[model samples]
Target: MVTVNEAKQKIIANTEVLTSMSMKPSESLNYVLFQDVRASISLPSFRQSSMDGYAVHDSDITARGTVLEILAEAKAGEGTMQVLPPGAAMRIFTGAPVPEGATAVIMQERTTRTGSFVTIEDFPVTPGRNIRSIGQQIMKGSIALPQNILLTAGAIGFLSGLNVEEVSVYRKPKIGLLVTGDELVQNGSSIRHGQVYESNSLMLRAALQQEGVTDVEVLYAKDDLRATIDALDELAGRNDIVLASGGISVGDYDFVGEALQSIRAETIFYKVRQKPGKPLLFARRKQTLFFALPGNPASSLVCYYEYVLPAIRKMSGRSDYFLRSVSMPIERGYSFDGERDEFLKATANQDVVIPLDGQESFALRSFAIANAIIYLTVNQNKVEAGDHVEVHLLPA
Candidate 1:
């Protein structure tokens, strides 16, 4: 068995990012930036007032009880720009463009206004103190945002302020899911005595969606070598990635390996030094990719998030899109199977993440309240309280 580092390397080597696509900024939510954006015009474009106050020249705000004559009123989005003369002030509201030749703003509360004259209570107000200068937030021709930044709400807001209504980003890759089992039954149908719930496919679909995948199709195949092969052949190359669960182990009904080999899909890696997901397999053909995951619900979800999501992010044009978990302190010092790296179910509260019920893979209730997976490598499972561990959050 190879170490976790080897497995990670194998996974990274098989990844290839997809091409870029054009999209409206409105539809660009969750899309990755393809290129760095530079500002064309200065943010604000003109000096403006930041508060509801009076815009005045430098000489108008000097000495105690200095009096100034009001020239004109400056509303937020006024008609034409004007120049304020010396010893003159303009009644300006919030966000109003600061008239030319004016450098400071005094709040209405700090000055007494009567008729056309105003008296300053606080003398010697600092010039340009409350004015938002042109290009202050963002300069013309300056880098607005770097490439590969995820299109979040704040990023979208920045783009909107810059009047950019469209952008180029990498689209999400489509994936097809194939589940194979003879003892499995869909939830809607009545189950026979020997049958069990078929939940792995649904879990994997949800996990992929949580990773920002938009297109997914699921199909089930009866546990027969020929039938599984036929199903896979039907779905070949129709998806950017194919996720197959079950039929990877050395069982009588296992046939995914045989089918992949027959299809001539290049096998990059198979098996990893991890519990419950040690039977993972990865393959590629042309631009189409495939992954064979375990059938158990928890195992299926864990494996897909750990390996498949990274591949999806890379394909989405995000350079640093890998899942990063917070290194939260653990609650206890405990022992685990020292054979492979374990991603035990865990729950995070405040700053500490606690490991929940630890049971066999097939037991679904063990993960009822789990929000994260605590990482523990083989041969070093014991951890003291406050010792930080990597945590992968589950998609709710």
Candidate 2:
């Protein structure tokens, strides 16, 4: 078969982004924008007060003890405020519009007020200090958010302040899952002499859910070849993607590889150069993508991040969807040799890297809480404590 890179390219080349509705601005929290967003109106459309203070022209306040008469009182949400004449001041609360000819603001805390007249306690209170200018936060006719920007609490607040009600964003993908193995038993059930609890499927399902996938249909099939193929064929038509655990290895009950072969499916690659996921399978037909991950939990997670996420992104109309990792200073490093590129489980304490107990792909216990991977590139195998490496971030 082909290399991992070749398989990924094949999958990318064969798929297309289906047209889907984007989330509205009111509901865009935690979603990615599909396109740039432009402001319909300038933020802070009118000059406003930043604090409870007196609006006065800077030229009018020359020295300490200088006094001015309040022309009008302004409050929050009050209607059209009249402009103040030269040397005149207005009583303004927070968020109140600054009247015309007002060049600066004298905070109420700094001014000694008596009736309508107020005395300035501090001189040289600059203009624009207490006044928020028009479009100070955002400009009119300018892009508010760029394409592929992930919406957050701050983004929501910004959009809300701009009076945005709707926004365009990508939707998450829907996936179907299947687990085939007679050696597997459901949780809380008594296991037969040779059977074990079915853990891989649940682990994979949880991973998908963490990726924002909500529409998931899970199925469990026996080792029968016909039964397995029939189940896959039915799921293929119903879901945009399929994830099959087990039945892809070289054993007699491993019918997934043969079933795909029977249907003339395009098997991108049946093996990886990695340890636990060496027997991984990838195939696709029309728009329905399928990934036959190893029954091992750690291996399944590796392949999921490596391959499954890309498929979900493509189906969701996201262009730059891929796994991301952060780098930190390695606390310890070694020069080692290995055939396949290794992704070791690691814990990061700020800039220090600590390898998890088990780095093998079959060690789910060690991999479960892993947040980052220690990327050891192929071929050469040696690193120092300060080496910068690549890692695949696991779901928290």
TM-score of each: 0.91, 0.88
Model 2: per-residue lDDT, tens digit, 81-187? 67889978889999988888888877889999899898988788787878899999888998998977878789988988888778877766567788999989999
- Which stretch of 10 consecutive residues in model 1 shows the poorest summed lDDT? 317-326
> Per-candidate RMSD vs. true structure?
2.4, 2.8
List runs of model 2 lying over 4 Å from the truth. 114-116, 188-190, 317-320, 326-329, 333-338, 382-388
Please report how far candidate 2 places residue 115 from its true position, in Å.
5.2
Q: Which number leads on TM-score?
A: 1
Candidate 2: what lDDT? Answer: 0.79
Against the true structure, candidate 1 has what lDDT? 0.81
Error of 1 at 300 (Å): 0.9
What TM-score number comes out for model 1? 0.91
Mark the regions of model 1 whose C-alpha exceeds 4 Å error after superposition.
Answer: 325-328, 366-368, 384-388, 393-396
